[model samples]
Target chain A: MCQLLGMNCATPTDINFSFRGFSQRAGITSDHSDGFGIAFFEDKACRLFVDNQSAVESPIADFIRDYPIKSRNVIAHIRKATQGKINLENSHPFVRELWGRQWIFAHNGDLHQFNPTLTGRFQPVGDTDSELAFCYLLDQLAQRFRQGHPTLQQIFDVLKEIAPKIAEHGTFNFFLSNGQALFSYATTKLHWIVREYPFKHARLIDLDMDIDFSTVTTSEDRVAVITTEPLTNNEIWQAFAPGEMILFKDGKILQQVLTTVQRLEMEKKDPSLVRKTKADPD
Target chain B: MCQLLGMNCATPTDINFSFRGFSQRAGITSDHSDGFGIAFFEDKACRLFVDNQSAVESPIADFIRDYPIKSRNVIAHIRKATQGKINLENSHPFVRELWGRQWIFAHNGDLHQFNPTLTGRFQPVGDTDSELAFCYLLDQLAQRFRQGHPTLQQIFDVLKEIAPKIAEHGTFNFFLSNGQALFSYATTKLHWIVREYPFKHARLIDLDMDIDFSTVTTSEDRVAVITTEPLTNNEIWQAFAPGEMILFKDGKILQQVLTTVQRLEMEKKDPSLVRKTKADPD
Candidate 1:
């Protein structure tokens, strides 16, 4: 499996501090040292970086520990060997362009027996179930709204419909953005938080680092962070129920829906619950 | 290179909207078709995923779009081959057990020439600059403050001292987290923002989607989002100086420093501003 870190904000900021501690686990603190990658959104585009090396030990990673960049959204990843070879081509936080806008994405999970016949509108550059799903999703989106571009709500509705079908194959957890709002979903483990004014202090569980939020933000500033797990021991991180979907914009959630619209269906077909019973063999 | 997306918040939130637009670029919209990965923080740990496939077409990515795993801190990525082969051993959001905690990391950018001596305190499992640097950084941290544990501020200070030394070698920008606060830095390009209270409506530039944040958050929620670039077009994304370091906790900037304090002196002596000019390679 891999790790994910993301930020969605109302005002422009930088991600230097969080990236520092997160990169350490790539090779220094833990055993995820596979490959690492990150993307920084500027305006409508993004600056992307990737390396086929353990982030903790990468020279580029070292440089990033001190370099500072401020943006409204950012996504990052560090890898562990699973379902693919350790190489640059397989690094995460992929990017693409649609409707003249650049989009970025990352995932941390597996799918079993998920063989979808793609029409080749979007093809995978690497061999992983994650990519196949991404393409399939785009294919669906293109097909569903081919008459014309649909509204955000329209796309959201379709995503809700398609998510479970893909999850039937295996674990699916991911993040997506396009110089706009952030989208994330998890059939298994996923969590998130929003930070605003009157903020308090936070401490990292992996490294000894603390900060006072009151000092750096205005009453107008708000941020939303999502991750696979909690990054701190001091903070109370919330867990997502089995089969849930969420949308974020301006550092706040815009929509949330249960995996199944009906409660009875959730009890028997919730992969999130199954994740707790085991089955993360990637 | 790979792309990254991040979010930090005061209260728990989810990323579903931005991720949808972002993932489109992985293989469907644009072309970061190598692989993808992401992590979500809960309390002191995270669940991570990685795929050696383009996010735009990955089934895992699709599931991520539909599944909603709420998290406070989230990191994600999409990959394009830059170093190493296309394999899972090199996927990111690398994780490590450090100081009895799991640390997650992801990196972007490249290093031209960087090979440092390692004391074997940390080792690299793959042959990429990222792993080497990740290990070296841990070795330095372990050697510097191995006695019990240091404070988060102390850790940031230590990184402040070490970051620029590595940046001199090449472009380094990254995101790091330890299930606590997020640490970010950049030598060339990175950006960030904060959001709170009175959240407004926002739309994705890549995909046709708009989200009204007022409906999803309470008055108590605040968040900070950071990235290598701006994820939304309507929001303002702040750029980092040539060398800057910052700490993010509870969705706000806690500490700001200039890692390359000597950049002025170096610039004075250097005949060419090669470093600055080369940063924007596009």
Candidate 2:
């Protein structure tokens, strides 16, 4: 089991500062400490760094602390391995490529007997269930849309159709991206939030640090962050329901499709669709 | 410090199978069991799964054992603590938004008193040096290119310049992507390899599994995987020297740059540079 952190913004931003405080939980200030790694995005690409030597003691991990490569999107991981061996090759935030774009990914779950035939243009380079899952998904997309890639809406339908098949096998919460948009899904625990106009001060849950968003962003800029757990102690992070998928673009959700079970759940609490009319309804 | 795994393809792939065997190193089969998480890409976005619980004992992790969602890209982490408190907020594979694209990151090192100010534009929600660095890098990009966005080349140059500054504080190694390409940098320990056509049969060093990549991939397919250590026992992994950055597209190196010091060091190591002709051209 491990913790995951992610960021997406309307404008470019750096993750070094946040990472500085986040990496401590692994084994130093806390105990998840096994290893850690991070990836930073720059335009249509990203810069990746990883260490198997426990971010607490690794000199390479220390180097990452001072590095300030910025990107519009980024993903990070700290591990506490539960299944596979502790070798360098079995790290988090694995990467692969398909189509003409370079895609990046990371996983935090354990799968049992999850062998699936991967009939596509992509394949796994490692032995983790996470990588095999990545391959299977890409193969499905290719099989589903054997021609030109479909629009996001069309693809969303496909994702909805596919997410369940995989979820049935076991836990299937995850995050994925392709330089244009970010997709988040949860079968059990996942949460996310967006900070846009009128950004406010955010305090870290793992560290006693705060930042006033108003100082760094403009009205035209918006930001979204998703994680397995809330990174801040004082922010409202909406938890993802079981079997829910949300697509994000331009720093906000472009499409969200909850399992019928989730909608039915809301119906149980709110007979009408009006679940939580804000203090001042628009 | 940590390990990372990612996949990006033209089709969907399942990671659960591979992750099943990979998570063992986190304290079960190995000792990394601090925490873990994973993210999967569907289109422009992704679905992330994480567990503060050890991947071996957590019921959620157990469920992941059999799940099989396929994706185009994925990221996973196994922690070994360095900075932030362990509970949940400091978990790796962090996510955020930038320029409307979703991005993900993971880290594997520790830094000393390294914190950067995040403008209102982007602020890290976690408490780790890796996240802070991620945010700071993005803020810089936003400050430098506000009119439109910079090209990949432009961004690459910025990474080269900023990476060293951050490295000054501590070890800096990370993986990042908006989706299109993967950018990787190594200061002390990071290795990667591109797997495309002419694939071969690979076996896992930690688990009992083998796959024939030649049977799954096509000549048009390409993949680049970066990690703190090699995952497979038979794969050829390229080691990154300190102060080096490379851009991966379609699973291959598209461009590469090195710090001035790194270039000089390389020049000194290889006599071929000075001789202009090698005794054995082969």
Tens digits of per-residue lDDT, candidate 2, B5-48, equal 65545455566645766676777667667677776654545445
List all candidate RMSDs to the true structure: 23.5, 20.1
- Model 2: per-residue lDDT, tens digit, A10-120? 787766656766777777666656667676655544455665667777665676676565567777877777655554445566654334244567666554445567542
- Per-residue error for A118 in candidate 2, Å, reads 0.9
Report the lDDT tens digits of candidate 1 across residue range A162-276: 8878777667777777757777888788888888877878787668888887897789889887887777777777777767888888898988887752222443554543322
Q: Which structure among the candidates has the greatest TM-score?
A: 1
Worst 10 residues of 1 chain A by lDDT: A273-282
Global fold similarity of model 1 (TM-score)? 0.48
Off by over 4 Å in 2: A260-282, B1-282
- Candidate 1 regions with alpha-carbon error over 4 angstroms: A147-149, A261-282, B1-282
What's the true lDDT of residue A39 in model 2?
A: 67
> What TM-score number comes out for model 2?
0.47
Estimate, for each residue in B1-282, the C-alpha lDDT of model 1 and write its tens digit: 766777777777777777887777777767878877777776654656666677876655665687676677887777777656655445666554345344666777665445667654344433456655666676687778756356779878878888777666566677777757777888877888787878887777778888888898888777777766666788777887867877888778888887763333443444433322222110
